[model samples]
Target: MASKGEVHVVHLYPLQMSIYGDLGNTRTVTARLARHGYTPVLHRHHPGDPFPEKAHLVLGGGGQDSGQARVQDDLAVIAGRLRELADAGTPMLMICGMYQLFGNAFVTVDGDHLPGVGILDVTTHANAKRMVGPVVLTTDFGEVVGYENHSGATRLGAGQAAFGRVRSGCGNNGDDGSEGARTGNVFGSYLHGPILPANHALADALLSYAVPLATGRPFEPAALDDAIADQARTRQIRRLVG
Candidate 1:
């Protein structure tokens, strides 16, 4: 396969916030990029490390409370740059803990406050009862599937567009039918089955947005054989939803 172009993916705090196979989201991107004939250049952005100035896509994962604390300060340091990238339409996928951190604040069960980047118009509070289950959602990309394991109940600000509607399972706060938050190309969600492998459409959407921005070229996604992946997703969704 001929190389198309390069997509610069920035993995934010991979060490601190990669729980429940969230790091697979980043791996999925690289694999899909290879399938799409794009050069995948991955950069891991750890705490106290320099963030890449030119990033096409930003990915982050969930973490425990301790992990969140570890990256809190570094996240603050890059908050301004992140905001700039977000406003400029860089595609970002922030899952679980990262999702909470992208919001206004995350209030722990003990009432300790962790400030967020304020990118997404949402707030999260830790709940004693954790929501853990396989999830099925109805998104603009079509029916999406994943697994959720979170104690944080996130509430979106009024009029904020959600990533999807919950078809099954507890999402966002488990009070609203909404599941995730979205602004521009930035996406926040509690879904974790590593997310992307089970929901390739969402990954494709992210890549489509990323390619043009990163390479300064028109994006024409190639048709790839996704029959196996599609079947797996169908089975999982059927098992979970039916």
Candidate 2:
């Protein structure tokens, strides 16, 4: 059990992954927790490290195909544990490659299939042409702004709740207006401008889920001055819209 004011945030595969400033997500999480008066205990899990037994939140970031391949086996080993955490209501934010790997499977452009952890009922098919640009999404939390760069087009299972509706840019796939998938406390998305820094509402939602599970009490973090974040989001949304 974590001590009072101590929240454990596990960063999965930080060394092997985190392409496109994905590590910034972890920094954002830590900063938010600290601002809310909680001590964020960051646990970085490398290839060989065992997954921590107690985690309030888990963050996984975007990676390239080669990076994904390198960590696939290690990820497979911990897949079951991840499912357990999800069942226990631990908040998870999986971005890009990590999001694909959390699903059923990802088929590469070369036709090789990479087995996923099956946390989300989705499948990704790699395309020769990559989708790379600023993305705007209207989510339950609010308007989310980020950038996406991926070759995988992910399709959610029937009846699965999407993280949001795509307002602009190619989401999960260019075909569906749906962007990302959410199951319970787990959220998977291709949005990779580190996500949380600009989308503070989504960040707070993740924290709302985590603090309760970690501290054995419901928590609503004190609101911070988000004017700058809002401005950044507005600029991104405008760029995407224009």
Candidate 3:
């Protein structure tokens, strides 16, 4: 989406929703902007409020089950706005709970099914075997690291996706696969730890979509710090086992 001058990023339901290091998603975007000599304007929205449309990027992160249910109720009120933004191609990055809500529906443990935002052609089923620990994803972009913790089975059928296979542990749909998903300009996934500080390439990819719209200039790639790169590798190794 073309920008209205400044790059605006909105963090939805941060105070009430979000799990893992989901907030790190926001941090990744803002920090990258700061490094590029731009001050990113961040906003937060909750239930009973209207989401502003002047956003270049929208970020939603992971959260707990009960929190997810609560936010689902609130998100319904602004579902139209979210759809509008997606339709306009404003890039979005959504994590666990956010991913779940954007899907077809979520089946809870007690046999109750809840409708979602219907953005992704997928469904989540509660499972007894909890998914936890570090995850290693081998993508065309390269390896990325993040933690996984969930109790559900996610199934995707012939839709947009972010990863190929679960190189290490359970991923997006809780089926021991995927790091996340990509549909249009929206990227949803289960990569925890906010998925940027360590995955600089991802941060760059996301910013490449938003910054050009905001500044009317093409994105230029840069190298990650050697120390940071080493740390990220170490983290990946740890995730391989931890």
Query: 102, model 1: CA deviation in Å?
Result: 0.2
Better of 2 and 3 by lDDT: 2
* Candidate 3 structure quality by residue, lDDT tens digits, 1-242: 32224578889888766657788889888877766656689988776677775788888888788888788777888888888878877788877778878878889999888788877767888888888877787765577777778786777757557654678887865554566666777877777875777787777778888878777777654454547755876777675756
Query: Which candidate tops TM-score?
Result: 1
> Model 1 over residues 89-149: C-alpha lDDT tens digits?
9999999999999999999999999999999999999998899998999998999989999
Candidate 2 total steric clashes: 0
lDDT, candidate 2, equals: 0.90
Give the runs in model 2 whose Cα sits over 4 Å from its true position.
1-4
Residue 186 C-alpha lDDT in model 2: 99
Best by lDDT: 1
TM-score quality measure for candidate 1: 0.97
In model 2, which residue pairs have backbone atoms overlapping below 3 Å? none
TM-score, every prediction: 0.97, 0.96, 0.88
Give the candidate order by descending lDDT: 1, 2, 3
The digit string of per-residue lDDT tens for model 2 on 12-121 reads 99976787798999999899998887889999998867989789999999988888899999998898899999999899999999999999999998899999999999
